[model samples]
Target: MARETWGTRIGFILAAVGSAIGLGNIWRFPFQVSQEGGAAFMVMYLAFIILIGFPAMLAEFVVGRKTELNTVGAIRDFAGGYWQYLGGLFVFIGFVILSYYSVIGGWVLRYILGSVTGGYAATESAAAYFGMVATGTDTLIAHAVFMLLVIGIVALGIQQGIELGVKVMVPAILAIFGILAVYAFTLPGAGEAYAYYLSPDIGYIMQNWQSLVPAAAGQGFFTLSLGMGVMITYASYLGDDKNLGIDGISIVVLNTSVSILTGLVVFPILFSAGVDPATSGPGAIFVSIAEAVLDLPFGRVVGLLFFLTVAIAALSSAISLIEVVVSYAIDEFGMDRVKATVIAGVAIFILGVPVTMNTVFINLYDILAAQILLVLGGVLLMVLVSWLHAGEAIEELEQGIGDLGSIGSLWIWMVRVPVILVLLVSLYLGVTGYIDFLTGAFAEYLGTL
Candidate 1:
């Protein structure tokens, strides 16, 4: 059978954008901004996105569109030899990420239902309410439901499954977010939130650069969906006529816009409620937003829309992550799409069981998948495209964009040197942090013994 291709250029762009915009943008971005000194982290993140993220994205695009294969086959066909194993790492990263990611999606789902029934709004304490639903039997059921939803979408094939779903969900996501942002602007503390969110603190960044750099870089890579073969898988469905450069730019722009918009909605609501945004930690979105909505006149409506937006965004990104492994199975093993999706979905759900049982596992899985694996996968891809297969990669890149000008060489040089250097620094910091965490946990356990 011939491989599936995207229905139109717009469909391809929307699908890629959907993958880029996920929980990382809506759920995690706010806490990261609040913790990293507001605009300081945003400044560093945007710098990395433009400098490293865009270039790394195009490198994956070149590999995918050139070979017209999944990540595993693409690498093996293009570079040959033991390097094929590196593509497997990308697939594993996607699987690992989606495991815990679905748990958060489940939380969003419960919040949506709670909005309609006034279940969560009536609670006396936001933290206590969140604690009740964030883990245990209910969370496990939600995780399974979210995974099933993801599997169903992927089983439908490219045009009907992934493309069509994003075509609707992405537009709805953008529109709902816009509505929320407008509402947030009328809040009492909007001015204070905007100042804090938009103002850069150079002094703080200089002092906290070591820790903040890796955090910002990780967020940049995570939000863009760069390192987990998502871009590669999406690009594989495109024809040579499609301009990879333009598509990549569109994904980055739209994804970043959503991230900023999320901060607009989140920070304003929290500030208006006279709450500290960073103190809530991972539960910030649920706790802060739930409390904000509970006190408003049409609290139920606001809560419903907010959680619905989050659910849609989460679903869109989850589809892409599962598709990475499903595509690999279909291309390499010649498996049916439906069967592949089901098998991959089940395995990922089983892996997520631990995450739902303990919140600590969520943080551990996130650190491993987002901070460590993503940076390593991204840097390897840069090496593969820029150094290992520089000639062919550039040739593939120039196909739809016309003659090779100075910009082509510049992109290549950027990925080869500075991009790799930044990723290596981020990777080093991530590993060191994980080790320190482990050491601290061990010492604490020994004290109890």
Candidate 2:
């Protein structure tokens, strides 16, 4: 059997953009901006994206295109020996991410259904409605439905399945969100909301630079879908003719644009309805946005569109997460694509069961995958490229990017030193934060006992 290559360059670019633009952009990025001094955080984040994110992305691309294999096989072929296990770890991180990620996808699906049925409109408290839906039988049914959708698409094989799916999904997501952004501008407090979102608070940033920098760096990596083998797997299908540097920039730009657009839609609606963005927390979308929609003309229709946007974004990303593992199974074990996708999907769905049943386990898994494992995976990948295979890595990069010049030397040095240092700091912060959370939770449990 021959390995699959993407049918067109546009197909490959859209698929990568689809993977990058997801729940992280819509749900996580806006909240981070709100908490991290708005425009100041945005500035720092863009800097990291250029300096750290792009180089790290290119390194993954080099590994994938050079070897033309899935994460484990790519490392095994490129470096051989014990280093291959590191690639295996990257694949496992993707699996863990998809496990909890699908659960959230289920929540988004339920919201779309509720929007159509006026379930959220009838509720006296949107928060209470979310609480009921987030666990138990409702969650399980939604999770199953979401995972089946992912499996069906992936089972169709690469160009027919993943490529075709994102081609439709990416355009629809943009059109829908574009409509929402235009609608948000007509709301009563649009100007104020824009100012609040776009204005820089130099004082706050100066005071909080220590915490804000790491948060921005981590968010930059997470938003691009790096460190979890998604990019590596996607790039493995590419031909040597493609310019990886150009495609990488395009992915980052599209992903960042969507993130900003989400804030345009979210903050304006919240302000027009007199909801305080600060107090909304993670409930900003479910509670605040849901309630705000009910008071507007044609609210149900708009609510339906909003949740539909979320559903599309979540699905686009979920496909990539599942693909990382599926590709690995096909390459490493020579499993058939359909069989690999089904087995992987079912296993991931089963893994999500405990998360859906208990919120504590969900939080723990989220911290491990997002904060800890992702940073560790990224750090190891950079080390492999910079230390173990610098000569080969540079050669691979040059195949797509052409001449090195001074820029190439700068790229190599940045990845080897500054990028690795930033990731190490992120790993330390993630570990300490997780430890503190666990210690506090354990203390509470002991008191109850």
Which candidate has the top score in TM-score? 1
Per-residue error at 339 for model 2, in Å?
A: 1.1
lDDT of 1 at 33: 92
TM-score of 1: 0.98
RMSD of each: 1.2, 1.7
Alpha-carbon local distance difference test for all models? 0.90, 0.85
Candidate 1 lDDT over residue span 1-449, tens digit each: 99999999999999989988988899888888977889888899999999999999999999999889998999899899988988999999999999999999999999998888887867778888898878999999999999999999999999999999999999999999999999989988899999889888899889989888889889999999989998888899999988888988999999999999998888888888888877736777788889887766566798899999999999999999999999999999999999999999999999999978877787788888888999999988898889888889889999898877888999999999999999999999999988887788689779999
For model 2, how does the per-residue alpha-carbon lDDT over 60-169 read when each residue is reduced to its tens digit? 99899999999999989988989898888888887887888788888888888889898887777788778777788989999999999999998998899989999999
Clashing pairs in 2: none
Q: How does model 1 fare in lDDT?
A: 0.90
**Weakest ten-residue segment in model 2 by summed lDDT:** 277-286
